[model samples]
Target: MNPILQARNDMLGQMEQMRELSAAPIRPAAQIDGAVAEAGVGNAFEDALRAVDAQQHQASAAMAAVDSGQSDDLAGAMIESQKASVSFSALLQVRNKLSSAFDEIMSMPL
Candidate 1:
């Protein structure tokens, strides 16, 4: 198997673990009065969008660096750009689904 393919699989496994950890319950510190529950649905979506925005910014910077010849390999930049594009596309789809849900709810008879 190619080294890149192996590395990609490893990264994906790690990301899955991270996602699982994020979904798990957390115990609040003594300083905090009560347990803050895992993020609400809306907050979770907002946070995901913010993370994607940050990734998009980083990818843009990396692409710029490659364009200016500041970076040696173009592959890394290309990968980052693709990641950003995929993330943005996913976010757009989520937004569209949410909007459709909202419209459906509004159309329901009371």
Candidate 2:
């Protein structure tokens, strides 16, 4: 099988996983002492960060396996590496957008 095709398939699988994760129902926030508690968005974002970290670790493990001769699938390792890189880049973009929005809100006149 071509490496490019395999990579594309892997990417599509990852996108499907992301879609499932996003489709999960968000738990309602609780009221505490007249203040609303944290919503599910925070948990969702944290879960996404954890998922990206897990992908990075998985990619590293794949590369290590290839290096130690425990695995002969260099192409698979490369695909995992690419997937991790893309996920990290996406997370960074989200963080940047959130930061800019925060800054913009702070600059608004009362």
Candidate 3:
């Protein structure tokens, strides 16, 4: 097996594991006696934002460690940085789509 292909597979598996771990259980609004559910859309969005922020912080810390000569894993630091950058970009894209959708709905003639 090619090393690059093996690495790609490993990364994909890790991502899948992360997705499963982060999967929040959904509860119908009625199940909570009118209390707001933690898995509500707004809460989900907030959670995603928090996760992205944490990723950014982790990447920053990894880079700092490398810079300070405390860690020799430059490649790992770079990968972390890239992951943070990609996640941030994804979050921004989602926000832009949501904003556009809101604007479109507001302009609809009732």
Candidate 4:
């Protein structure tokens, strides 16, 4: 596997392991499949929004700490801020493309 894919799988495994340690029950594969079938793209978009919000909150907290002299990690704050920016940009692009596609389909002659 490519490095990126390998790293993602590794991260997922670690997350599952953490959940197991914490006693948070992992969803069964069949239940997860059913939930996805029900919510589809909407659930995925909600997850993305939440992830971006969490990143923004984290960046804000990091910057606050730096400003208050509670923490000196300027580089970590900057990285968090950039990650939030990039995720928002990607979501915006996806929305624009979907909008364009919908418009095109509506404008097509029957």
Top candidate, metric TM-score:
1
lDDT of 1 by residue, 15-89 (tens): 999999789877465435566556566987989899999999999999899889998657777777888999999
Q: Report every candidate's CA lDDT.
A: 0.84, 0.89, 0.87, 0.79
lDDT of 3: 0.87
Query: Per-residue lDDT for 1-110 in model 4, tens only?
Result: 45356647887999998888679666765675675454567777778788888888988898899899998777767766777889889988877887898899999999
lDDT of 4 at 4: 51
lDDT of 3 by residue, 1-110 (tens): 55356658998999998898569576666664687555666787899999999999999999999999998877778878998999999999999998999899999999
lDDT of 2: 0.89
**lDDT by residue for model 2 over 4-81, one digit each (tens)?**
897788879999999996898765444333567555767878989999999999999999999999998999899889
Model 1 lDDT at residue 64: 92
lDDT of 2 at 61: 100
After TM-score superposition, the amount by which residue 110's alpha carbon in candidate 3 deviates from its true location, in angstroms, is 1.7
TM-score, ranked from best to worst: 1, 3, 2, 4
Off by over 4 Å in 3: 1-36
Clash pairs, model 4 backbone? none
TM-score of each: 0.72, 0.68, 0.70, 0.64
Query: Which model, 2 or 4, shows the larger TM-score?
Result: 2
